[model samples]
Target: MESFFEFRHVYKGFDGRAILHDVSFDVRAGETVCIMGRSGVGKSVTLKLIMGFLKPDSGQIIADGIDVPLLSEAELTQMHKKITMVFQSGALFDSLTVFDNVAFPLREREHENEAEVETVVTGLLSMLDLNDQRGDYPASLSTGMKRAVAIARALAARPKAILYDEPTTMVDPMMSHTIADLIQRVKRQYKLTSIVVTHDTSLARKLADRLIMLHEGGVRFFGTVEEMDASQDPVVREFLQQDELALP
Candidate 1:
């Protein structure tokens, strides 16, 4: 099967400082691929490139058959309807209630009527066990609740692919598991292609059909979870060991 998303010889840098170098990978439709690396390893940068938030210095990023870098801003906006991102910060609107936040994408991008938006957002919030929070605002939510609300908002777009930027970061162990399980559930239910950028090896093991390990601006490993576990690279082993030690 051809790749549903691809990064070919991607190279990105900032002010002469290289961040990603010759990094390349692919994700098939309906597959969940986790990108894992230590902090500042370009994991989130990869996601930003995919979302067209940043451009690679020299590379070709193809998503849904569109050359992302080549698309105009307006074209990219339309393409965004099919590709949504859930930021690690849970980038919710402070002014909107949870219901409205989840419903925002549906209303703005998809232009679904109120009745349709009501049905979709209602079901999503309910599935995420966020029904009671619908009336609440971001300021009133805990870290986990805020992340849950972000996930609901991302789903409101009914995206073909979802990019999660550190979905489990800064959460307690229980909440981390909850977020991981929720991601798995959504992927299976929607058959959605997902790219999760996280440092949590445990979460990667749980949610990744395949793993891409980045080290020093390169792909150190890209294969099944078992392959990653068996990697002989010292960097890979050391990174995994460090994460294991960090667990409580």
Candidate 2:
């Protein structure tokens, strides 16, 4: 299988602190990989590094076989065009209505007419079960609704790879699984390669085709879901044992 994204012994730091250390992982095309870890273990940092929002101190981050570390300003913008992120807080613009908010990226990048944009955005919102809230403002929507809108907006660009940051955050049990199912559908239906940053074990178990567990900014485990469940390493077992709390 071809790896669409690869972390090649990546090392990154801030000020006088170190996070990732010789961190290496890969996301194969058409696979959904969920990153699982405890708080401050650099799970989210890994995603940011891959997205080129933060630079790695040493080593390479390759996406589609191109070393992301070498990408120029224009290349970075183009890369972003093919990759989208669903923020933890939903990241919807406060002033824009749901339709305009979802349409923003599409309008910025593509010369799609208003009708074409509306059709695509409406389809996405419908897929996410957010059709009714299309006319509402971000503030008027609930947290779950906002997240759904954020996802709808992310789809506007028709990204090849999606980075999900704590998608289960701010959602209750009733609506949490919808987000999970949507991610699954987005991967299978759209043939997307997704990198999900989440500490929610249940979500990981449900969404991950492969699971990578991080500890102290280093990878402690990497394998199929069954392998994680059957892990013998104490740290691995201990980490798996905390599946109940679901804390980040």
Best by TM-score: 1
Model 1 misplacement above 4 A: 109-111
RMSD of each: 1.0, 1.7
TM-score of each: 0.98, 0.95
lDDT, candidate 2, 57-78, per-residue tens: 9999998777887888899888
For each candidate, the alpha-carbon lDDT, in order, equals: 0.92, 0.86
Candidate topping lDDT: 1
**TM-score, predicted candidate 1 vs. hidden true structure:** 0.98
